[model samples]
Target: MKHINREVGSLLTRIIEKREKFLRAGDHKDDLLGLLLKSNLNEVEVNKNSDGGMSMADVIEECKLFYFAGQETTANLLTWTMIVLSMHNEWQERAREEVLQVFGNNKPDYDDLNRF
Candidate 1:
């Protein structure tokens, strides 16, 4: 578990560093990391006399929380979906047919997902 935590921290640090480079170059994105960095910069600017903004570690921790939360939500969604499908054969068949019709023996495309 300690090794895993170190690995995750290292990865998040690398990601944050790369985003910081882009941010410094004026290539600001509206994504989560970008927004966090922007907010941190704003806070620092506002509180030039004190340490009032999130540190790199704090940003990484926030990212970790969001990452885990998203995974949990996705897992719960899939679990519930499977349970519902198992209980409703007709709905499951319809869903299967729709998927097959939309993507038969091929990888699904993002544009075609709206058809479902």
Candidate 2:
């Protein structure tokens, strides 16, 4: 388990570094990863002045937790939603129409989700 954790941690560290670089070069987008990157920068500044801030490891751990937990939950929800939609085609069509109406071809933002 310890070895597995170390492997995962190493992978996550590389991922975070790459993401930081992408964030620096890419256009701004409001999303969870973007928000976390902002938080990580703030935490770094805070840690420079005091010891009461999150470390890089802590931020990495949080990113890992969010990735795993959020991915699992979203996957489960999508699986169940697909199952339910399959069982009820009428509702599925309705949902598809609603999504198209709300978001068209673009991804839904927070306001769109709330309205949906």
Candidate 3:
């Protein structure tokens, strides 16, 4: 697990490094770190739990988890998709056509995913 974790970490770092290279070329942000940050919830509602509001620290940790989980899942899905397509070229073509038809605008909505 450690070896596999290290390999994944290394690859992710490389991916981010490459993305940063493009930004260095011309991109700039008012808050570079802010651009990398996101919250899973817009706001915390008041509950019986004290003053009620997602603590900033908790928000940050959750964001890290969300980012890592999303990245890893996406990576695995793409890898498997490629392997499956290679092993079944006929099915691959059909899948491509369906995807194109549903998301012909190049943007897929939640509804489109359900069709899959």
* Local distance difference test values of all predictions, in order: 0.92, 0.80, 0.60
lDDT of 1 by residue, 1-116 (tens): 99999999999999999998888888999988899998898898899999989988999899999999999999999999999999999999999998888789898777776655
Question: Which has the higher lDDT value, candidate number 1 or candidate number 2?
Answer: 1
Model 1 spans > 4 angstroms off: 107-116
The order of the candidates by TM-score, greatest first, is 1, 2, 3
- Candidate that beats the other on lDDT, 1 or 3, i.e. the better one: 1
* Candidate No. with top lDDT: 1
Could you tell me which residue pairs clash in candidate 2? none
List CA RMSD, all candidates.
2.4, 6.7, 11.4
lDDT of 2 by residue, 1-116 (tens): 99998999898888767777877786444777667886666676777766755666987788788888999999999999999999998999999998898789999888878877
Q: TM-score each candidate.
A: 0.88, 0.56, 0.41
Model 2: lDDT to the true structure: 0.80
* Residue-level error in angstroms, candidate 1, position 84: 0.4
Model 3 Cα lDDT, one tens digit per residue, 1-116 = 88975675666556545544554565544443324421112123335445554554544445457778989999999999999999999999999898888688678778768776
